[model samples]
Target chain A: MSVTGAGRPRLATKKRPGDTAREEILDASAELFTTRGYTNTSTRMIADAVGLRQASLYHHFSNKDDILDSLLSGTVDEPLAVGQGIQGVEESAVVKMYAMAWFDADQLSRSRWNLGALYLLPELRTDRFGSFRESRFTLMNLYATIAGGVVQELESDVSAGTEELPFRLVETIVNGRADTENGRGSAGLHHASLIATAAVRVLGFPGDIDGIHDRAVRVVADVTASSIFEKKAGHGQ
Target chain B: MSVTGAGRPRLATKKRPGDTAREEILDASAELFTTRGYTNTSTRMIADAVGLRQASLYHHFSNKDDILDSLLSGTVDEPLAVGQGIQGVEESAVVKMYAMAWFDADQLSRSRWNLGALYLLPELRTDRFGSFRESRFTLMNLYATIAGGVVQELESDVSAGTEELPFRLVETIVNGRADTENGRGSAGLHHASLIATAAVRVLGFPGDIDGIHDRAVRVVADVTASSIFEKKAGHGQ
Candidate 1:
């Protein structure tokens, strides 16, 4: 929320400056890209918004695509870094999961509207912006790794050989494509967090392994199964 | 997927020979609005796309906003109509839930890209468009009503009076949001469907209700409890 001098309105880089100009450019680009969209936004418009000449803007970025690539890459990398930092903390899996969710929620919510806008834009999916694919994979991997660690730490008897418990657990929480546009709300996030937390807890963490696995299994089964049953009843009647 | 008029370009309107030209203008406008965005898409560009004079186009729509308003209202209304059709059907709560989910999902996926685009546009959100607020409210109410009915049909002991159950269940399945750009995927959808089904089943249906309820409750308890335990264990470590 803090705007530094680096982000202040200055003349365009007809005369080359340092990384400060680059930072300012990106800051402005993220805002515009989120609100106006990439295809609709022009380099000149970006320069005008930042008090720079169109020609000068090119000195910093070869084209508008460069700015977009930079913006998406930078934004996605931050969360991954945060995840990595927490991994080194040596905290218990449950605490780690909470920490990760808290971090993701905090960061995502700050610019949730814009981030949502960016994702919805079809242009990002095209090959022109390959960052989309890479960033997505990176995020999935991060979640799986963290969730897997928690699973291993909690479940002593359950061998990790049969299934990728952490990946599924994280996927369960994070996946939201179902239920249409309504699916993307605060409620979904809460459900995912609850499910992930429960999964980790049931796998038997720092507590007594006895009964924990059964408890966790029963919880998942009941929640999933009951939902299915309810839907069938609605249909039958 | 079927185009009504394949090779032959249908007349934009049959109201007036002159109005046909206007219809073509609007048709072109809708396509651009979905792809290029509202603000970025100019009246001149729209007219050009339709092979018409800009002045002639204005004869139909007062301005670009008029074109956008028409497109958005139509999109919103179509879904509302589909949702309304469900109320007339007399079925069990479980069946209704599934049908509603299916309907919602189908509509969303069909207009997935456009909905995101239109929703993100700032001008569209402003008060220039009449009754958008009412439309949105109506949609939310429709979802709540459908979800509530499903929950009621599933629960046998209405004597207990669990009012919040409907809201919680509906919100969990319908309004759950994701951090990713696409906002959930196939896996998320499956999970939500499963959860909804399980919830209804546990509440119990008519035949062999007691047996089903007993089994459901045990399963839910075990799953919920186990996940919680896993979370605690991870934290402790």
Candidate 2:
């Protein structure tokens, strides 16, 4: 049975005892990994923290590294899917674009501090989850598509390629200076939200959807458009 | 006499034979503190890394925490001086503004990865050397002065307060989604460079600067102006 069974309390599953124990183990592991780094944390610590014997903990997971992988994937994988879903939608391109960033930021803030530390670990860097290159690329592509749709919607003749758009848009939003050191709340979140709102408005999106997604889309589009145009003009000089 | 002078190639003057050794210990400690976090690193490891006995290492710095403070102060204090120096400059406000950010980025990048890790440590959050809050606030004040100068140069009737101008300008530049995690390059360095350039241009200074800064300024100015106007218009809504 899955960790979260339908209509059942999360910890109170009717599945095999092993499955229930595994879920408990993962839950405890996630908290520890998030607070203490993966390397500093030990299997014995995890087992003790979860009120299980060290050997019992071993029975649920192979080792500390396995727990690390499971914890990270569980948090990020769903967010990635949500981002993908937004990309798939053909609604107002601006709406789709804002949704992707909002969801990503929300998910990242929820787990990024611990997960970000994991990325920095030497062991994880070489492991399967080390390279976030694929996830980044996918998200960037979605941003570019959304940006292009906005440009088209604005009725501008500018056909800036997708490759260029994501770099310009995402760079303005995700650069680390805007985020807290541990990747919690910081100027980055507020800036992206505002920029996204401005971008949609500038792209001729109706002001009806004044929610977070709409506001963020408008801000991002406006700032991005202005920045790109100015850059192009400066090159001419 | 000075810390750097302690590690000299020639004997210069007949100093204590162990003077060079003391300097070597500090130097090694600094490198370790930059790379390995304070809690993760131990005095014995640092001493061993420097090819010295732990007792010899203790003779230079009192403990691990003391070494961390020394490393952090050495790394960050000079940048703070540069920040102060630019603030004191009698040059055009735009020049002063640009120089502040330019120097900050240049110095911060000299040891960015280490400095970034230093900022991430929780203990440092309360410690003066560890907290970036003061330094960042000081820098913001400088940016605000520059932004105010730009308003005056433009002869715009809109009178923005010093506090508001910095927050607005920084918010516009650093707050975007592209500037956060999942964004490319270092956030602080990229934004600082971009803002330094933009502050100069937006202040209506003669635009002989490089293309990137020039473009960024123009774009940022336009967005800031539009956002302000929009906000005023929507104040009642």
Candidate 3:
């Protein structure tokens, strides 16, 4: 009765960061899953981390797979919706490309845990994670779509299918953060705009993208302040 | 004694590719670790896949960690040596960048299994894989050095740390292959030169890369034929 949920009383007081019990579980799971290997971390361990009994943990997540699925989906769903929402925005492809890169890379970098690191978990290769993979692929396609426009606008000779490079360039921040966190490389290798610039540059953006940069920054600020997530906040995830 | 190594009899006939038992073990481990999940795979599973007794597997590798380490190191060691050897090659940074990207990405694509998938293993973040992480960092720095040369040659205004993007762009092929194999994307998304072009282009190569592409192809052909591995062969692995 002390806690917000219908679950039994917590064995310990609130300690994790999130506002709700499910979010608390996710926050704890994210830390444990990324630090301890996914296969190494168990459902019981996750429950214990969040100060909840095993039964209460199941009330939120059916199993470890569900917890991981929710964690992975959290990283992508916003970007996927945001990327899709902006498809019809009246900005040029260059600005759109910059906006998406800035937003997505920033999300990957700013997340409390580097859940992006889990994108390659071998467990994800299974059918259980197929939806996550598809959402990711859809995000890549959105990047490619915007990047294809940049390719056309620039008239660059970049090979076909190279459009995916922009998205891939953005995703490199995942590794950049991982390596830097491990103390293996220089710091700030994954700065948001730096990666955004490089993501656009990968399309042969040529020298002096200052104009595109300013416009895209404005676009990012404008669209994100009023993105679809806000428009449909209470419609249900 | 029918087999080459000093171990017990085999459990199955030769089925894996490799010139030696060590190579065969690596091949088997690469496939299993990338698919079955690294933490889930036991030494016995690898031995069974390779048709060796668990004792024979131990004779070649101290444990599962050692096998995983050897598999990962195999993917990076050749690139590091060749990349370092060519640091002084009489070629433009553009050509060197092209050659390195082409060679490294091709190695990733051409590998029988997507061992590059293991590069992000959380277990690799541990001290046990410190040497492998260091070698990979060395390789990235080599790419950055060559990429830095390209930036200077072009007088690019890229951010100070952006030299790393060229290397990271080449690595996208790892994800590209994993995605394609999962039937999530097109087949040739990981093609070597397509990605190499995108990698070099990230350095602001601009249009008309045909000349640089041709020269780099020649560099790749020349250097790989007489590289250090051949010169140091039989000097002891």
lDDT of each: 0.48, 0.48, 0.79
Top candidate by lDDT: 3
Residue B100, model 3: lDDT of 90
Candidate 3 chain A has its poorest 10 consecutive residues by lDDT at: A228-237
lDDT of 3 at B215: 88
Individual DockQ of the candidates?
0.06, 0.09, 0.69
Stretches of candidate 2 exceeding 4 Å from the true structure: A1-27, A91-96, A110-114, A131-212, A215-237, B1-40, B90-98, B123-237
Error of 1 at A109 (Å): 0.4
User: Per-residue CA lDDT of candidate 1, range A1-237, in tens?
Assistant: 223242444563422222456665676777667656666678887887767767766777899878877766654665565555556554565565555544454445444234434543556645776655567556656765666666676554433321223333333222222112232332343333344333343334434323443443343334334544344322110
Q: Give the TM-score of candidate 3.
A: 0.94
Question: How far does residue A151 in candidate 2 sit from its true spot (Å)?
Answer: 7.9
Model 3 docking tier (incorrect/acceptable/medium/high)? medium
TM-score of candidate 1 versus the correct structure, residues matched by position: 0.52
Residues B65-131 of candidate 3 have per-residue lDDT tens digits of: 8988777777777877667656668988888888898888888888888888877777888899999
Ranking by TM-score: 3, 2, 1
DockQ score of the complex predicted as candidate 1: 0.06
Best by DockQ: 3
lDDT of 1 by residue, B1-237 (tens): 212222233333232212345545556775666556565689998877866556666666788877777666655564455455555445554554444444444344344334434555545444686475456446556655665675566544322222222223333322222223433342342233333332343233224334433443443334334544344322110
For residue A137, model 2's alpha carbon misses the true position, in angstroms, by 5.6
- CAPRI-wise, candidate 2 is incorrect
Check candidate 3 and list the clashing pairs.
none
lDDT of 3 by residue, A10-59 (tens): 78988787767888889899999988889999989998998999999888
